[model samples]
Target: MRTFLSVIFLAAFSLFSFAQQPYAPAAALPAKNLAMFGRGLYPGNDTTYHLLKRSGFNTILLSSFYIHADGDLYSGDSHQPIIHQGKWVGDAGYVKRVKDLKTKSSISRIEILLEGRWYGQPPNTFDFIRDWYDPAKAVPGIVTGTGKESTLYNIIKVLKEVLGADAICIDDESVYHSPSIIAMGKIAADLNMHMTLCPFKRNNYWTEILEASDNNLVDALYLQCYDGGVRNEIKDWVQGLKPAQPIYPIFMVRGSFSTCDTHKGSKSVAEISKQLRGFKKDYPGMSGAAIWQMEDLNSFVKLGCAIKQPSSGTAKSVAEFLSQLKKALKKEL
Candidate 1:
């Protein structure tokens, strides 16, 4: 009888220890890569995917997934929804292209960005999550039936099962509910998917989430260093978050919002390269950086940024832009 009691105690203790393990940062990407975003990627064809495959980017981030009240998912301004009533209703060809982009090219990580609006956008993704999540019915590391019924769980599950996404980037700009995000993180972990934070500010909010998860749930911090986040400093974030994971600064390149000039947080290639050098100097531990989007890059290539037209066609011009950007990422400053 004593032996049986001893066995039970030991098993309980073992489980406790496993649950209390501290967060160890996940391994950094082997090489610096760009995160392609915007409407350009959604409608990409063989030619587009082909260019991206050889574009030298190892990671692609599909931006701004919004969740409706009925548990449907939409990317940006597209009329068609990606997920409707917990089922995938998006284009199959888009999925095929993504799969091919991952399997056939250098891309290894595909992350879907979940964004909330600043204002006026009713029923935002984060807002829905905050409103729907009930702590009383929540379980640690398990998605209950109630959870499955919720739009949050279904949306995340679809991202994992259907899209096979490696991670979900939390771009919760408007909503700042800690519990909702923490709950989502748990669901993400339960589904074998990692979560990353995209923060322009609110270090305390992010820090709380990291601490609550013991830093295990969130693997990286994609710091937005463009537009509203232009004033964000790497050193400040590093000091504030004390994150075990690497932080990648996202830069808004030229032609953002279809403008050629460097206004509104858009920077020229040379300007970006120089800014990167400065950031590297400030945070020597910086491991990676990301371009704001493919839309801006495409716009810049298609229509010159206050200069002469691109010397080559779209594909070639885009390739050259990527090559230059990659070099900027790799070259020693």
Candidate 2:
């Protein structure tokens, strides 16, 4: 009886020690070739999906995920839950469309974007991560050591399993807790998913997380070069992070946020091309670039921007924009 009790104690102690171990860093993956954010992909029609499949973008980032106080996951301002109480509660049609896009298109990667901000509104998604993530309870795969698991962990797993997401794009504009992010990164790495940082500012905050993750879990940095990050320079960010991963500059196209042109950060096609040329010149090793979103591309077309249309002129605006972007990145223009 004493021998049996001793064996059980040893097993429990081993489990405890294993749970307390820090996450092992893995090698980073290559940066995306050409990426676009699908901010308006949900509730989209066949036409939009068709455009995306032929858009020449190799990566698609589904944007703007929010986590409620009740641990329900929402996309953008949609009332429907993508994950309710750590289960897949999202639309079946939406998942099918995403899968179909990947199957038919040049899209090699799909990343779920988690954005948090302080617009003087209620608590955001990262805030929930900060509140719920306890380091002592965090373990690989099962984040909460307890069998119940954490809402964040469940959400990550569901995204990977259901939507076939390859990475989690961190767009934490307000909440900057390192422990929570690092813990989240560990969980992501364990699940065979990479983490990408979308930072407009806060270099130090990002640097800390990168250092803690051993600069491997984070494969790329999508630097916002528009809006609040208008003043951001690639050289400055490169010098700051000293990153092993590639840094892609994200540009906001014309007609963002319902504006026809010349929004705070929105740039015309010509302007974007010029900027990309300059960025490539500054960082000779620049692998690729990304567009801010798809909604803006549609907006530019609807707002009657003078885009050179094909013979049909049907869906030519989006195609034209993408063509120009690809040319800008490829050629030395």
Candidate 3:
């Protein structure tokens, strides 16, 4: 339970104000999105998005959503536009450029993950402490509970009109005692915003979360199987989670130059394939795979020890990994 994602770095980006194109929240895609960090939305470069659409990844997970004291749901991160050198910019033209690619690839599933803790219960409120560390981290979520209940309604109202986002990821690390989540689930369902969750350790928490949300509201679950010293084995985790909803394992991709890597996975292409084979053999069903933070993709693509061929890590590695993953997912469990 003692693991979290890394923050986003300031990447060079350009902005394109396209009169804020229409934001249409499409039907939720199957749970296989790539989890990313700041400038958010690959905030890395235009190539990031282009490569992803090429890499066969279906969804993009921009991290961190916080609840402001003002009841405004701010994105702790995500593909939020910012000012650099006194100029308004957006993912260095990544968002603007990738906008056209969405319909072409399954990568159309764009979501933001919300995390951190909250205090109190009465006002039905929580704290957005992640913003305290850095104000630039405040990305927006639909505001609720305050004087205005339509905050979510409003975001949905203009989703396609402004950011063109399609879904929300509940990364509520706070575990605050409140009805907000269950309530939010209802809102997501009504708005047709595909909702996802990242729950770790507590099975009861999973139970409670599912209990709170409406049936089918949580379209997918991305389980973190690395960093934390838990029984992260997919065979072990799926027993409880799969029954609730479709679950995808998001493994931590190892860096290329690292020697002292200390997590359960970091399995080479063949090793990962073997693991998927084992999962398939056991479950006889289930599918999809995801990785944390697309920034380390070069490292992620660099295959680990169990390589059987040269050029172990390449864009090919991603394509191969995803192909095997999709195969396993296609199996009927």
Candidate 2 — which pairs collide?
A: none
Give me the runs in candidate 2 sitting further than 4 Å from their true place. 1-32, 118-120, 135-148, 307-316
- TM per prediction: 0.85, 0.83, 0.64
lDDT of 2 at 157: 89
Model 1 lDDT tens row, 5-101:
9999999999999888754433224445555554467746777778778877778887767776665788774656888766888888888887787
1-333: candidate 2 lDDT, tens digit per residue: 999999999999999999877544332343537888888887577788777888777888998788777777788836578888678888788888887887767777888998885344658888778877874654334344212266677888899889888889999888888778888887788787789999999999999989988455688889999988998889899989999878999989776877665676777766777788888888887887888888888877786665432221223467776777666655632
**How do all the candidates rank in terms of TM-score, highest first?**
1, 2, 3
Which candidate has the highest TM-score of all? 1
Candidate 3 worst ten-residue window by lDDT: 5-14
Residue-pair clashes per candidate: 0, 0, 13
- The better-scoring model by TM-score among 1 and 2 is 1
Question: Cα lDDT for residue 24, model 1?
Answer: 41
Candidate 1 achieves a global lDDT of: 0.75
Q: Which TM-score value belongs to model 2? A: 0.83
**Residue lDDT tens for model 3, 33-152:** 343332234444555555566655567766544444543444334523232221233343545754554756756667656555333332222343322222234335433341124444
Candidate with the larger lDDT of 1 and 3: 1
Regions more than 4 Å wrong, model 3: 1-25, 31-42, 67-94, 117-161, 176-178, 241-244, 256-266, 299-333
Candidate 2's clash total is 0
